[model samples]
Target: MEKYIDIIKNSYSGYWNYLKNEIFFQNHWDNYFYGLIIISLLVWGLEILFPWRKNQSIFRKDFWLDTFYMFFNFFLLNLIILIALSNTAAEFLNDILSSVGLSLQSLQIFDVDNLPNWLGLFVFFIVSDFVQWNTHRLLHRVPFLWNFHKVHHSVKEMGFAAHLRYHWMEPVVYKSLLYLPIAIIGNYDAKDVAIVYFFTITIGHLNHANLGWDYGLFKYIVNNPKMHIWHHAKALPKHVRFGVNYGLTLSIWDYIFKTNYIPHNGKDIELGFSGDETFPKDFIKQELYPILSKNKDFD
Candidate 1:
């Protein structure tokens, strides 16, 4: 009980320090708060200059709502809630493993510490992206998970900020699944791989932006706006029932798994699910709907 109390107290202190650093712009280069803003501005500028959907307004519908989601998901929920919960869970798991004479180091598949930093980052990036790809597919295929994922698909007008417009529970799901795989790779400073993190953020923003880019020859390598727009298409393909383009950072997974579906340009495809019109519009209601509502027919 005392250990749990200490963990909670540490979480509060850590959260406070983190919030202060983000607000004050300390470690500006590595700060995700600054990174998000810079990336969003860059992508927004591109969208304004070369919008695929010309009629889409600069201040698109629900733009502010999505923007709020960006900060909420990226900072508030992630920093305050997830960090605390994950830390506590990690400590508890460590205690249990210690009692059994096992530790995380004993569970490592390979010693990532011996590898070059670049190689370590590369391996981590690939594995993490694959994990996320699978997690994304589950979110669509499973009705219960789909309820939470609906917050993201509710986007009617795609934009840069729309990238982070997701239910807070998503991080809980993603981090829970990502934790073990990442832990097995050995610990490394997040600052060492900030580039990969920023790269994914940029790609994610571009994927949701009103921009038409396929990365041309590299379309199969990296996910781009053209390919990802189809992922949000209101109507699923005749054969594909669950979803398509489940790739988060790389399109290679989709191609490798034969889930890549880009029948057309997808520049003007309708977005959102069938019953999206009835989905909660207010942020509070949207957050609670998945838990409270009796609508299980997310398919």
Candidate 2:
């Protein structure tokens, strides 16, 4: 057992050493945050051409409210990650990845080595998305955890900001749970992890977008605006559509779970919760009151 532990420790050391020395990763710290910029462009661009919700305006009061939620959660999650997982915990993750034939060192978006950037990007997005879909399903089903998740479901509209409009606790808890199995199974490095998150935020906006543009071949593999917009439907019988399109990069998991919802057949889906009077309006109140209120109706 001691020998096994030592082997793990050595692997961790090597992976951490690789990260500390990698020039491309060290040089591109800004790319992690740059994801938000690309996503903003995608939404703005789509809204200009083929908006799904014809009456929906992108710059209204609801948009700003949802934007605030996204920024708040993004900042909170980054702060927690830096303070809680940056040093020793990250090294431990590196060790675990190495054991699984994945190295935190190998997943960097750019490399001094000869690895293909495109393949790495593809793998990172696909795996991380599966992790997200499963985690999201668990959040909805698990009674105790659903309290935090309700913050997301409370939103009454579909927009770019609605994508990030999530309870702060949900990201922390769900992400932690989802990554454990992946860490044990895959070789995601810090840089690859960052790119995955970058794509996630971008794709997240695409999924929540109120626009109606179809990107052809990519739409099959990626969650386009229409498919995800349906997921936010406020109508009953259809509200359960929330369980589908969990992927930020691919629709494969949704298909496997039988949770995939395609909006092509019909299009009467409305966005937001059905019982508006029952759902909280203010963001702060929503978070606090859900803990106090018993959602017997959810039964």
Candidate 3:
């Protein structure tokens, strides 16, 4: 009787230990995918409920192009980061940026070191979103960067997949520059960085989605598909319509900088520069040889 009671107590303790650490702590990726599935489904449902444009379906060519880059990043680029630059680079970056006021070090009032990891992550997300919003704007305004960025705007339509059809060089350059600031100031580890990566991906898909649902409260914090569609507007002249909606997560920067564009008509605006004489059809040409022909020669 006494022996049986002891066994029961021991079993309960073991179960509780597993529940606390293994079940709760170890479910990071599982929870990640689960949340992603839910968000993806919500976006899909919104697409069906209030699609801004139904005529523009996924482009077969663009679909494959996006898939190729997605797989390449998942299989190859990540492997390189994990192997080569994941460790020392993050530390070196953090140290250099620590001296400047660019980074928020330790959650302390002056240099608060007591902030929990969760709070730190939340702060990093906001800061990085601001950085990306402004950096993207800079690209649009700057002439040389526009050459690379125009490849993204070259698309004439919007969809979940359209968000992925970016110039490959833009990612390499933009991400490296963005990460450099975060790595220096944010004290982010590989795991935090991974969170930012997927967060950006999920946010980006939502950005290009045709969903019409609007969360009045969230509009200030996050940019919706409606706002983003205008960013891809092709006919609105250079630096006017497409220049706004630069926020990936927050709309504060866009609002503050006068880059926010609110659509007046309930219609899918004509996108892509039709004036070009010869548009590249294949991914290889757009991604690889954007400069082969002179810009003026195109149209």
Candidate 4:
């Protein structure tokens, strides 16, 4: 009981500290808040300079809503709820393992510490992205998870901020699945791989931006706006039911698994699901709609 209380207290305090540092731009180089803003601005600038759809407004439809979602999903929900809950869950799992005379190190498949720093970071990046790729597929295939994922597909107008405009439940789903595979790689500071995080963030923003970049020869390796727009297409191919282009950072996974589908340029593809017209436009309603509503024809 005392241990649980301590965990809760530590979680809150840690979150508070993180929040202060983020807002104040303390250690600005390592701050995700700054990173998000910089990446969004950089991508938005690209959209302004070279928009694929010239008719689309700079202040696009639901721009502010998506902007709010960016901060909400990235900071508010993550710091206030997800981080605390995750820390507590980790502690609880550790306790259970200890009771059985085991530890996380015992379960580790490889000690990354033995490898060179660059090699370890590379392994971590590959494993993490692959895990996320699989998880993204599950979000499309599973009805319950798809309900939550709809909040992301709800985007009609793609923008840089739209990249982060996902349901808060998504991080919970993502982090829950990410925990074990990361743990299996053994002890390594996430800070060491901060470059990977920022790189992925930049790619994600570009993937959802108004730009129509396919990375030319590297389109098959890295996900791009041209490829990802099809992922949110209103009409799926006749054979493909769940979803297509399930890559988060790397498109190689989709190519390797035969899930890659880019019929056309997809520069002006109609976005959103079939019933998205009826899907709640309000953020609160969208969050609750998945849990409270009975309509389950999500495809």
Query: Using Cα atoms with residue i matched to residue i, what is each candidate's TM-score against the true structure?
Result: 0.96, 0.72, 0.69, 0.96
Ranking of predictions according to lDDT: 4, 1, 2, 3
lDDT values for all models: 0.89, 0.63, 0.60, 0.89
TM-score of model 3 (CA atoms): 0.69
- Candidate 2 clashes: the total is 4
In model 4, the runs with Cα more than 4 Å from the true position are none
**What residue runs in model 1 are displaced by over 4 Å at the alpha carbon?**
25-27
Per-candidate Cα RMSD to the true structure, in Å, reads 1.3, 7.3, 11.7, 1.4
Off by over 4 Å in 3: 1-50, 58-61, 73-114, 192-195, 237-242, 274-277, 295-299
Model 4 pairs whose backbones collide: none
Per-residue alpha-carbon lDDT of model 3 for 72-175, expressed as tens digits?
Answer: 44334434333234434445555566867444344223211235777767767776787777778866776566666777776665556556566655655566
Task: List model 1 lDDT by residue over 1-299, tens digit each.
Answer: 79987987888788879888888958758888888899999999999999899999999999999999988988888566887788988888888889999998888888666789889889989989999999999999888899899999999889999999999888889988998898888876678778888999999999999999998899999999999988899998668868899999899999999999999889989999868989999899999988996655643
lDDT of 4 by residue, 1-299 (tens): 88887887888888888888888858747688888888888899999999999999999999999999989988889667887789888888888899999988899999887899899988988999999999999999888999889999999989888898888889999999998888888868867777888999999999999998899989999999999999999898768878899999999999999999998778788999888888999889988988887656753
User: How far is 222's C-alpha from truth in model 2 (Å)?
Assistant: 1.2
- Global CA lDDT computed for model 3: 0.60
Off by over 4 Å in 2: 1-29, 80-121, 185-187, 236-242, 263-268
